[model samples]
Target chain A: MTAPNGMRTMLGRVRGLGSAKSGFAHWWAQRMTALALVPLVLWFVISIISLVGADHAAVSAWAGQPVCGALLIALVIAVFHHAQLGLSVVIEDYVHEEAPKIVALVLVRGLAGLLGLIGVVSVLKLMVGS
Target chain B: MDARKRPLSPHLQIYRWQITNSLSILHRMTGVALSVGTLLLLYWLAAAATGPAAFATAQAVIGSWIGRLLLFGWSIALFYHLCNGLRHLAWDAGYGFSLPSVTKSGMAVLGATAVLTLAAWIAGLVI
Candidate 1:
């Protein structure tokens, strides 16, 4: 139904603020990423700190394990994804040149994806002994 | 390009530096640093996955003077971002809106970041 002289809905009152406009989707995404970071970051920092004195072989071996490898890959992805999202907002808000903003966005997406994929593949090879 | 009207000539150059302003600017600064740090993390992951030889190269870089410097900066960035992010989280929850609290938290976060960075470095050295 619709809200009108002859209809049976209240679209008139809701016209400005209802489904006509976007919801807090950006805010939600930010919060979701932030929440994911909470635990992932804690684990990552611990891992990094714990591995500080480790040698090349030890690090390789540790990261070679399936569980550790998978977690590192997850860390890489989450990091890049979060970074991309954060940079996009900054560029969108502050970059005065549209061309530069678009360039930055594309670069961030491509570079982050490439780096994250490389990290994941590296982990897989290490774990699988490839 | 679209042109917009401006009100006056007053700008950031005209203002005196203050704590709140510094925090605001440093928040963005740390965000950018963290973005770069993300690439380094990705590099570490990729190197780890490649194998012993590749991992060795990555290790050498990470152990190099330049790499150590970058890593040190990245560590500072990590801590700064974490502390500042916590402040943001608090604000999101409708807390710390008062000027005094904001400045206080800003200083606290800065201090926390410094302490954490130093602690991490000391731990790294011990390792």
Candidate 2:
């Protein structure tokens, strides 16, 4: 059933309040990434702890493991994505201007994506023993 | 618009201290700190992928006193963010909304963060 004459649906009302008219996706994605990071980050912290005082060869060998590379790649992606989402919230809250806000958001996303790529590539290089 | 002379919401300084309030602010603060710390992670990855000299240079910086201090702070921030993020996830799941529970969880998050951070540092020092 449709809403009566000019009455907005609940979703429609929410969509109206957001600047881009698409707030839910960002909110959901942030939560999803946060959930993914929980286990991945725990693994990362434990692995990093284990690698302490380890030499370059030892650390590289550890990273070269198939499981290690895959998980690290996943962690890098989730982490950067989550970081971008969280930073954008802070920026939007404090920036107070449209132009700079957009610029800051773009920069945050671009830099995060770039650094995430670099992280995955580095892991792959180690995995391939190159 | 009447925005030029509009009233504003009372800011932090005017408010009494509360657990939820401090944790809310700290959640954002830790997030921003961790974003900057990501650069250090990137550097380590890049250094590792490069030759021995590059890795050594990276290690030297990371092993320095200032670097250690930064690392400690970053670790604390990371743990705090992790704990608080989980608390937020619990909130998202429709639990911990009551005032008592919120206060308890907020304190628990902070307590967990401090303990975990100290444990991590001890492990680092030992290994």
Candidate 3:
């Protein structure tokens, strides 16, 4: 059977390629994280601004609050997850070499995870130590 | 196949600079900047968790001139990324696809980002 253009069959046009299987999950997760980050980041900016010129004790106290700590942990997780997804796309776009692309993707994920862990642990410590 | 000899589509250099194009690229640029800026947030949190002395040192560094500059840049980047990300979400939802809507939304995002960054800084300084 010929396609409308008579160049190839309809199945030939679509065969061997339907879905990558993981692209949608990455995209949906990116959007979900962005949605979560909107409120989290706005609250964080306002809180941090209000704490400007505040002493270490004051800042610690603010961070130690149950609500603040929870939101902060949420923000950190969302930010890093979003960043990892974003940087991975950037690397994939610009880094053509297969090996370097994989390396960069791994490095970005590792760094994002490490920093995110530090943020969560730090917030937890402030809550416990305060 | 010799990749160098392959026919290539029009590249960025072929297009005239425009608001929509600029804003689209700026979104990606700000995203990357904000990614690096996350380190500053992590440092602050780590210091706060450490002790008063460490917190003081962190404050000192952040309070310095260069620190303020970096903070200013990060704040701008954050606001830009946030605003544009919203615009992206709207696009994803299948609204504002027309050329005029796209351009108008781009301008609105820029306006919002500027207002937010400045307002935050002013509030930070005055309050």
Candidate 4:
């Protein structure tokens, strides 16, 4: 069978010698997350700055607001996701050893996921009170 | 795969330093630093969620001289990464590929980072 336009040849696809076929997805996701983070991070920095020197009660009250909690959660997810994607590239570029590279990738992904979860939970707790 | 001596591509040691190269490397460096800095953010959030005591502990750590210094560094890194990241995005979008344009954009990124970091710190301290 003939390969379709812009498609890999059947034999080439089967061999899989060159492309992973998923690099674009990773690249696109990184860019999308970066775009989302521009505003989210700006908002977070400004919010924290405004809350500088504020008491615990005030900070809690501010975080507890629905809008604030939602945005904070969004920020956390975007930050961790973007960070994971970025770090993965760095590891792949620097770590040439096959086994260690896999281990590092797994560790980075795990840490990113765990930290993102903790951030979400924290925001939720603050929203719920105490 | 057999372990064999092979001619590898030229790398950093061979190239002369330039703004483009410097900014590109700095971008990665800041990215790594920001990755580590996420821990501080996580700590603050967890502490805030825990209780007044925990939050106070976090505040004390973050308010200390060392903590402030780290924060200052992270802020600079963050702004630098953010601005250069936008420059990268512009390049990805097929803009600013010419040599002069690239250099100009690199300079602009540095300027933007400085202004943003300064503005953020000022706002943080003043407001």
Candidate 5:
């Protein structure tokens, strides 16, 4: 249903794009994670700076704090999710072959998610004081 | 896909170098770098959680000259990505689209990255 001005109807244009549909979800997720990361990343940088030259016990004790551990877990999730979304775009743009693109996308998502989980688990372990 | 050879759309090779273009590319580059740097962050966290011995090993490696060099690069990449991501957010909010404003903001992002990275390193050294 293209119009006289050579523009297809809104629904017509996005008819069969699969999961992404209109891409609003992906765009929003990226922006939301970026927004969350702004504060988390700042806290992380400050924490790391404060911990410089800190002994193992001191660093471990710091991480064992509930506030620190909670924030770190949040940082890990947000950062990895944001990175996964960003990398997916790069792969889609550069890897034109369908099979390779799918493989790369899966690998990126899987690894990012796995690392994110490990990061959270590490923080949780510290919080438990073990 | 088309089977016949046809003139392709203009790409990077056709455009003159500009701050905006450079910043756009640099943003992606830094993003990739930061993604890779996440492994180091994960290692530090895992080591800290594991035990004093593991933590000590992480500290020793990270304190080495080569490790510091890599950390320096990671620091710059982190700052650059953060600054440029904010710029993208501003664009999403429909600001800084004018040519002059775009160029100015690109320069601002670069300046902020340098200043923030420097400040971070100096603070790290002091503390």
Candidate 6:
């Protein structure tokens, strides 16, 4: 195989580098989230449409149903997870500074966690009639 | 990283406008858009967890014309991104590599995105 340049070769760069498998995984997750989101998004659209004429309590109560709560929880969780993964790629692409990249990634992960908690707790509150 | 100079393929300017190009670029565009939109989502989530006033304030922004416009844009971006992301998934699975097939599916993604976005907005108006 021909070497790419001064210090690197094409095969060396492509061979089991940090970018292949995880590259596919990142791409896969984005698409997976996109696929997972189809029905979830449709359900959310329907829910939002229903909420148009609803009062606050009505909105909360409607969301408080078991099925609805379950879906909403899934929606938020999927959303946050998808967001984190997407942003991670973006950060990895654009953020050249090492420390900031790690920081931003951690921040995204933390934000995802917070959003997940909010989603789960909200669903629980809706579930127990609280 | 390969820092060596090599013969390059024709760039964007060299090729005629194609659906695949449009859709592929749109994916990146929507990614950036959704990055901003996520902040809005965060606002929504925080408001939902907060008191009624806070939630209403958030709702009020969404109820406004600017908010609606942004939401509308976000909606389209969402659907476009979703469709193209699926297209990407198919590619990753070792499918749709042919140029003709790529263009065909890319058009489908664009068409689906527009249809869904318009339908959603219409549905919103009706309800």
List all candidate RMSDs to the true structure. Answer: 3.9, 3.5, 5.2, 3.8, 4.6, 6.3
The TM-scores of chain A alone, one per candidate, are 0.76, 0.83, 0.86, 0.86, 0.84, 0.79
- Residue B59's lDDT in candidate 4: 95
Q: Give the range of the ten consecutive residues with the poorest summed lDDT in model 4 chain B.
A: B7-16
RMSD of 2: 3.5
| TM-scores of all predicted structures | 0.84, 0.89, 0.90, 0.90, 0.89, 0.79
Cα lDDT tens digits, model 5, A1-130, are 5566566777775677778675888899999999999999999999999999998889888988989888998999999999999999999999999999999999999999999999999899888983
> lDDT tens digits, residues A38-129, model 3?
99999999999998888988998999999999999999999999999999999999999999999999999998999999999999999997
Residues B1-127 of candidate 5: C-alpha lDDT, one tens digit per residue = 8799898865878878878778888999999999998898899999998888999999988899998998999999999999999999999999999999998888899899999999999999975
lDDT of 6 by residue, A1-130 (tens): 5555658766877777664765776766767777788789878877787677555567667767879888888888788788788878878988999999999999988977886787677667656653
What is the C-alpha local distance difference test score of each model?
0.78, 0.90, 0.92, 0.92, 0.92, 0.77
Off by over 4 Å in 5: A1-22, B1-8
User: For candidate 4, lDDT tens digit of each residue in A1-130?
Assistant: 5556447666866663658677888999999999999999889999989989987898889989999999999999999999999999999999999999999999999999999999999999999994
Rank list by DockQ: 4, 5, 3, 2, 1, 6
Chain A (candidate 6) TM-score to true chain A = 0.79
Q: Candidate 4: which docking quality band?
A: high
Interface DockQ per candidate: 0.62, 0.77, 0.80, 0.81, 0.80, 0.28
Tens-digit lDDT string for candidate 4 (B1-127): 9889998865878878999889999999999999999899799989999999999999999999999999999999999999999999999999999999999999999999999999999999975
Model 5 lDDT, residue B122, Cα: 97
Best by DockQ: 4
Worst 10 residues of 5 chain A by lDDT: A1-10
**Residue ranges of candidate 6 with Cα displaced over 4 Å:** A1-28, B1-4, B8-18, B49-51
Worst 10 residues of 4 chain A by lDDT: A1-10
DockQ-based class of model 6: acceptable
